[model samples]
Target: MRCPYCGSQDSQVKDSRPAEDGGAIRRRRVCPDCGGRFTTFERVQLRELTVTKKSGKRVPFDRDKLARSVETALRKRPVEAERVERLINGIVRRLEQSGEAEIPSEEIGSMVMEALKGLDDVAYVRFASVYRDFREARDFETVIGELSRPARSAPDDGA
Candidate 1:
């Protein structure tokens, strides 16, 4: 790795450890030329995935963009930062595991709505408003109504 301090081309790793989140590797290195120490992180890159918009336009899937949308919905909410990070990570992992080169944008929006629905009702409504393109207040009422409904129980058979 190149040293940031002296711009040296050679550096030796002095220590290596797994990052706190276990998502990356942290390495402590020292430049042989200047004896300057620095840290670096390494992470695995998943295969590139494309997002197919409603207009039939294709674009690369962006995690930061996804996070920003979710964060906007969750703004001023009571949800913890860690929980939000986990939620984003979970959604990204699911998309990656689908093993599809291209996925519909609507599918991604639906996934975010589902995740937010469980995280915070207000956030869910906020995200749904934008995702569903709410034309009137009644649209929110409809979604809120759906969220308010009790889950159906399985029908019992004579045992």
Candidate 2:
């Protein structure tokens, strides 16, 4: 591993363990040159994902960008950082397991909206406003209405 302090290419791993969520491996490393210590989290990549943007441009999927968007929406909210990390991990996992190397940007946005909807109402709306491109106040009201409405129950089995 490279050391961030001295930009040295030689770093020794002192310890290694599973991350808190168990989705990644945490490694404690020390730079021999600067004696600086830092921790790094490593995750297994099932496959490289390419995102098909709305502009017909294909780009490599960025996990950090997605995390930043969610965090921005959840800013000043009651949601915990751990929960947000889990949510982002779940979304990435789903995309990776979907058996598709290229995923649509719209699909990714919808997935984020759905996950945020269940996590926090305020955060959900915050994301929806940007994702859905809410221009007027009615747009916000419409989404809020969807939240206020109750879920439909299953049809009677004629028991």
Candidate 3:
């Protein structure tokens, strides 16, 4: 790995172990030239993904960008960090397993919305406002109403 500090091209791994519940490998490395130490986490990619934006532009999938968007929604919320990590992992797994090399950006957003809806209500609304492009107070009210409503019960089959 290249050294982040001195931009050296060489580094030595000092330690390695499982992280993120064995979803990734964490390596502690030291830069030989600058004597700088840093940690890196490696994850296995099932396949390279391309996100097809609404504008018909395709961009390489970015895991960090996904994480950042999730974190932004969960910001200042009471949800635990571990849960957030799992949520992101689950979303990525689903995307990778979809059997498509390219995925629509809307699909990704919907996945995030579904996951957040189950994780935290406030975070769900926060993400929805941006993802759905809420333009008026009525938009917020509509979403909030959906949240407040109880789940529909199964229709009673007469005994």
Candidate 4:
């Protein structure tokens, strides 16, 4: 590796360790010419994944965009960033594991809604209303009702 201080091409690794997240390798290197020490992070490069829209248009799959949409729906709420990040990571992992190079936009939207639904009801409704394209007030009310209703334990539960 080239040294940033003296632009020396010769460098030796003094120490190697795994990053805190354990996703990459952190290396301590020293330039032979200038004796400058630097740190470098190395990680595996994965193939780029693309998402195919319903209209046959293909675009690169972006996890950050998905997370941003979720964050927007959850704005001003008590939820923290780590929880939202974990939720987004879960959804992204599912998509990546599906082995499909291209995923539909609708599927991604639904996945985000499902993830939010489990995290926060208000956020879920907000995301769902926009995602499902609620055209009337009744649609929103119906979703709210569904969310408000308590879960029935038995098939014979009658109220």
Candidate 3 lDDT over 100-130, as tens digits, reads 9999999999999889988999999999999
Candidate 3, residue 157: lDDT? 69
lDDT of 2 by residue, 1-159 (tens): 889999999999999999857779999999999999999989989999999999999999999999999999999999888899899999999999999999999999999988998999999999999999999999999999867755445664767
Highest lDDT scorer:
3
Cα lDDT tens digits, model 1, 1-159, are 888999989999999998638877999999999999999978665778899999999999998899999999999999999899889888888898899989999999999988998899999999999999999989989999868865344654645
**TM-score result, candidate 4:** 0.66
- Estimate candidate 2's alpha-carbon lDDT, on a 0 to 1 scale: 0.93
- Native-vs-model 1 lDDT? 0.89
lDDT by residue for model 4 over 12-105, one digit each (tens)?
9999998635646999999989889999977543556788887899999877698789998999889988687678767777887788877889
Report RMSD for candidate 2. Answer: 4.0
As for TM-score, the candidate ahead, 2 or 4, is 2
Better of 3 and 4 by TM-score: 3
Every candidate's CA RMSD? 6.2, 4.0, 3.6, 6.6
Candidate 4 lDDT score relative to the true structure: 0.82
Error of 2 at 115 (Å): 0.5
Write down the lDDT of every candidate, Cα atoms only.
0.89, 0.93, 0.95, 0.82
Off by over 4 Å in 3: 150-159
Candidate 1 Cα errors over 4 Å, as ranges: 1-20, 25-42, 150-159
Could you tell me the lDDT of residue 61 within candidate 2?
A: 99
Best by TM-score: 3
Candidate 1 residue pairs that clash: none
